[model samples]
Target chain A: MTLPPLLEQSVAFLLPYDFSPTVLLVCAGAALLYHRGWRRTRGGWGQALLFWLGLLGMYVVLQTQFDYYAQHSFFMHRLQHLVLHHVAPFLIAVSAPAAILGAGLPDRIHRHVVAPLRRNRLLGHLYAAIQEPLVAGAIFVGLIYFWLIPSVHFYAMLSVPLYNTMNWGMAIEGLLFWWMIFNLRAPGASDMRHYGYRLLVLFLVMFPQIALGAYIALSNHDLFGIYAACGRILPITPLIDQAIGGLLTWVPAAMMSVVGGLVLVYRWKRQSQQVEQPLSPTLGCAR
Target chain B: MPRFKRYLILCLLPLLLGCSEEPPGGWYGHDITGVMPDLEFNLVDHRGKAVTAEDYRGKIKLMFFGYTSCQHVCPVALSKLAAATRELGDQADQVEILFVAVDPKRDKKVLDEYVTNFTPDLVGLTGTQEQLKAVAKRYRVAFSYEKPRDNGFYIVNHSGAVFAFGPQGKTRLLIDDQSKTANITADLRRLIEQSSI
Candidate 1:
């Protein structure tokens, strides 16, 4: 006999506990690796805080009523996407958890997951190729468009596994994009030009979202049938919710990248200014 | 200005370019428009007739989910909805309130009397618990009945938000339970005008 949907969901999330098993397992794994890595390197509190916060944020985003509400509300679903894509990635990027995570992972898991990607010729080459600024920017922007299609969103909302994959994909990819924008690596390509490329990609990422937000805000019809009939939690209309969600996407979501880009530009200018300049020999001795 | 300041201004220039005209229909209710169409339900109305979504085709359906015995939010909301429709004046005839009872037991007996107190146009629908649940699910409403009290009476907690469906049966907007009568009337007016009901 087919069990009731609500009962099934409660059993999956709450019977054993109020938390998701996936969230618990992931947190456990991340904590283990982070602790192991921290013990080995004695990383500073800033990095530690960022990593933990990212993990915690992901856990909250996954386990909270926000996820449940998202099933019935378009506005909440949009906010969830924003948090997963922008906020989660920014946290992970700031943490710079690569070395710590790699070091912390068990040897077997690391070998199977990390070593293969690093050693495989085709995959390694593909990774190197995508790291190129233009390619990375394209993929990031393309993914944003690809996932926002109504059918794609409808299907993702209906399926648990697909939705989870979408969330994870956005987080990992967005983290990678944010990492590139942060750009703490040794200078490559044209030194100053690389910084410009980072800033350019950062600025470009905001455009499509703003445009999409504008469209949603202006739309007169319910674009997604899934969230259409679900009534409001607050005393607002679906159009108002869509408009608010649109404004949310348009403003803060876009501004975050813009602000990040401005910081990069500031650093670029400061760094260049910090370079030593020689005085004219006739006027004064070179410093 | 310093070059840094100039660059920053240039970066922010794009953000200032987003001025679009206002959308059609200056609405008081939250504009749902063509978003999701409100779902249809198959149930017995107070008059003992099987009413379907198609039955409400030519008039705006102001829907609420509550039991007749609801003591708090439900009564206040139903009264407000009734008042708002009354405020529609001559056009009030174009509006019908559908009171979907979530408490299958208590609601079935008292539903007719509960709704008639508001308006003759108001409809009260009830069915088996499973049938009620299926309709509630369609509308994404949360409803649960409590065990019987010492006096054999219990409350059925349900969603209190009101749905305003256009004459074509599409969900046009959501009305807050706490919204003032004037605002609800204004929204209903706009819905009727826009839908040309």
Candidate 2:
């Protein structure tokens, strides 16, 4: 059936520019699992909203006509990364969906597949290694530097496979990094025990990002010629685009660190309070 | 000491494998072997004949996207490419420049005359919007048109890159506007020589 013209146009705009089956499958699967879990647990609406918004934000940037703009425009590409690597992942991780996702799995699948995978010694060791606070923090910043190297960026833009790898790498690394920061389990139970160390890592990663962004913004010359080589989608000057992209990389991305630090401080305080009153009968009285 | 030697060997293994010797000097253009897919497209030639990339299989193909009416960039780029091919002397026939026009509305009438003004080795190509979009998407380039003025004059923005492919259609190098004619000529020579062997 034919829809109204305006609705048709909107639908067309939402369609993927370069469709990838893998993106479609992963997003759909996540949405399905989250919905099932949310229903079964009668999850809080606030957390569910954050989870859905984060998932939808990632899918939109990666799969819609937005992807085309991100590819062709420097500023738009930076905006896409801001959402993918910072905003969306942060929201998802902050919602603390791990327990809900675990509950979402069917009993048989959890027993035979998920449980086995989680118990694998090599997998556990690898997870522990990457989640080590210092290593995780380094990887979080290193990936940004690695992909932005002018020579590497040129090839990543020109080649489809390299471009896909760069994007997927950013997204996966963002999830892992933010997950480490925001995991809601007690310090004694989680892989990373020190809230102080996580806070330090958050603060440490900010400087390099600011320096790189300032260098790109303040330079008179174009650092990324790939955007010029492939024509820009918008009519803005190259310098203006570079400046805006640099500002995005500079301000909002670094501000995420401050926000994460605040969350950790709150959690740290609450955990301390819980420890102090562990055996008190009036523990619920505070609430 | 033995363990240290083993660690050193392990570190050096990747360097040894990755640093295979090249000629005295590598091609001036960015060597992009195996990065992009093989050159391929379906479009209409200036002669109104439908053609695919296979039609020009034996020659080194240099493909770029622009409109014929693009006043500055298209002319300068075409001339530089023409000069590069001319520098090849008799071996000039070994190369073919595919100039794909992204703006079909205005280009269709004048594309033949425009390309002929540059070099005989260059072939002007245009196609339906779908076909043009497919080709542009394949190359990861982009093009957009500005709104026309009252007198019907407009501007089109398009990629300034020339993608060079080997005789067998293998992706080879990308020549941007900053590349010198000499550099392009040298890289083309290397591509032609390598393909012949």
DockQ leader: 2
How do all models score by TM-score? 0.56, 0.91
Interface DockQ of candidate 1: 0.06
Residue-by-residue lDDT tens digits, candidate 2, A218-282? 87888899888889879898999999999998999999999999988887877677777867542
Would you list the clashing residue pairs of candidate 1? A221-B34, A221-B35, A222-B34, A222-B35, A228-B36, A239-B31
DockQ for every prediction shown = 0.06, 0.66
- The 0-to-1 C-alpha lDDT of every candidate, in the order given, reads 0.72, 0.87
Q: lDDT tens string, model 1, B1-197?
A: 69999999888886654333322356655565554446588888987788888988999998888888878877788778888889888999999899998776767777777778767778999888777766765555656556778999876556756778988788787665657888888888888888873
Worst 10 residues of 2 chain B by lDDT: B20-29
Regions of model 1 farther than 4 Å from truth: A1-20, A107-113, A183-192, A266-287, B1-197
Q: Write the per-residue lDDT of candidate 1 for residues A1-287, one digit (tens) a residue.
A: 97799887756563221246777797788889889988786777877887788777666667765665655567777787677777777776756777777778888988798788778999867766777666777787677667668868755654456667877787777776777766444335434667877887778778887898888878897676545433344445678877877777778789878767776777677656554342422211010
Going through the candidates in order, state the TM-score of chain A alone for each one. Answer: 0.79, 0.92
* Local error of candidate 1 at residue B188 (angstroms): 33
